[model samples]
Target chain A: MNYPNGKKGSLTQPSQSRPSGAGNHAFSNRGMTLEEDINETNRFYLDTDKAIIHKKPTPVQIVKVNYPKRSAAVITEAYFKQASTTDYNGVYRSKHIDFEAKETKNKTLFPLANIHNHQVAHMRSVVEHGGICFLLIRFTLYQETYFLPAEKLFQHWDDKLKGGRKSISYDQICQEGHQIPFQYQARIDYLAIIDKLYF
Target chain B: MNYPNGKKGSLTQPSQSRPSGAGNHAFSNRGMTLEEDINETNRFYLDTDKAIIHKKPTPVQIVKVNYPKRSAAVITEAYFKQASTTDYNGVYRSKHIDFEAKETKNKTLFPLANIHNHQVAHMRSVVEHGGICFLLIRFTLYQETYFLPAEKLFQHWDDKLKGGRKSISYDQICQEGHQIPFQYQARIDYLAIIDKLYF
Candidate 1:
């Protein structure tokens, strides 16, 4: 099965040891999740000595911990904290790369509320400091991902603040953002787009 | 008082918070930890817009969450996850900067165990890719900090693999690493050293 993002899903007969592929599991259509695909691509990049990028783990504030014998120290009480920056950032070719990856099922427009105010401020700082910053938006319904630079995002964000549309239309994204290629191992292949725009 | 690199002894008092005639909490002389000082310095840099550097939040693997009515979701179970990279990373002058900070009470030698194998590997990758990478080591007893470059650290790490010394002597570090100056608001002025050395 070929997904809209160009991800190929493999079909195989059910192995008796594995649970029957049905119900909730059906949502995963064999093609990896966008985050999973990006992770794999990053791993491939790391292994081949190309670029160093990592998904910043979700931030959580731990309150209570239990040290059980013969087991690891387990955190019992915690709370998710709003992240001050984006989900992923690292260095590629001596340049700082900062970005947020968000997937939306809606196909018409990517909502501005999907991003946080502090994140916008951080991306602005990165750009002002001469680092490369952008947003990786995946339209799940369409299975297409686009890389929107921080400058363009700032413009749209400011426009929304000025009582404009709170979301950017799909057509505008198609015209302004760089479409990331979908490959097998390199999945998102965002760096390929970077090679064109940045290099 | 000052503690070891493992970050024990956090139970000192606020009585020492005020140093004599300093008009503030300057007993940082005996009480403030190196990490706290670095954090303050990073805050100062951010406020001044000199450079953008941040400590990545501690990674926690969330197991369960509770979404109560009309409030934020609360994480109920989680575990601290081993970080895959260095503690601090960001861009300085359009150059990628990555580093790990550790303080030791041991005045003569800084043990190799203070650093993890993966962290060393990650720093090596950063250096190989032309990004600036180093270890910020503080000798708590002497109130001294040194920036040990990744290249020098890799040499010592490789020597350990060859059955050499597992620790680098303070004298050796004093010769190889750049001594970072302590400042008032910019507590650990490592970037000042970067301005001198890299620039």
Candidate 2:
């Protein structure tokens, strides 16, 4: 399929050769970050009229700005601020879709430290309000992305709070999460899983 | 009512007195900008479990950064980028809510120049996807905030494209739009109109 932008093969392929074995199987889309994959997928969804999701801009606290006479305003001093909500959110099939994409290099388990408390609270609010909330987690070692519902994530988060396992094992993820099938255009075809779960 | 953060009366009342006339009646919530009022209203909505809406962060293109040892990374150079979507969006009563807020100081008409072409396109996509979309316009001179539905906005937008009036008259806004009632907590109580119109 023809991609809208000419960034077709550049983002999906790895730049350098990797050692063979199980790692070789993860070569497809090796260099692309989970954020890039999801952004591409969201763009595809928008282009196809399938969804209207978008990644919110990175939050920043602007301290100073300089407006040149003939030029655009330049922000000279700023700092990154912790986001109060997830990275991506929008409407899909008349439902509000909210999710955070995370990637871990570990193959055995996904660490809970990647997520913050406020994000969990935000996800809970979304779920309570009848919106579709979840996590798009990519295990880089296997190049396998999984869709874990917010409800399922809350269980592990609560357990972590109660001094339980700090991470969800790969086996547990395999059991609880649905593997997102990678495609040429929609690299992370998450809506396919959403259709089955929600629709 | 007690406003959170103790910013109660500070933002609502003007710092100085105004001469008695049509302009005098606009003193309520005079100093606060449209953005500030809506943000305060959204915070109230969130606190009351009424809605889960939030304004997207201002999009910025970071060009340079300095990583000081044992200190937060400082963005040394950046420029504001145009947003691809509306300012505020979230879920309310199981329905996706998306909107852009604009303010006009002119008493007779609101210039269409405040909104961009891409924002209108984003609103159209939101509406086509069955999400509730609208514009919150604040007439600062009259202290009136109106909720103009996306469907109504498109007619005016298309007219502008066809070499029609570049601004929507105040009378037209009064006729086609619903005036949002100002409240103590929910400064720009827009959902009141949404409940009547959509729910």
Regions of candidate 2 where Cα sits further than 4 Å from its true position:
A1-30, B1-30
The true-versus-predicted C-alpha distance at residue A25 of model 2, in Å, is 16
- What local lDDT score does residue B111 receive in model 2, on the 0 to 100 scale? 95
Task: Give the Cα error of residue A134 in candidate 1, in Å.
Answer: 0.8
Every model's TM-score: 0.87, 0.88
Q: Candidate 1, after superposition: displacement of residue A5 in Å?
A: 11
Q: Of the candidates shown, which would achieve the greatest DockQ relative to the real structure?
A: 2
Docking quality (DockQ) for each candidate: 0.64, 0.82
Tell me the native contact fraction for each prediction. Answer: 0.71, 0.86
Give the per-residue lDDT digits (tens) of candidate 2, residues B79-183: 999999999999999999999998887779989998899999999999999899999988865567899999988999999999998889999998999987666
Name the runs in model 1 displaced over 4 angstroms.
A1-25, B1-30
What are the per-candidate TM-scores when only chain A is compared? 0.87, 0.86
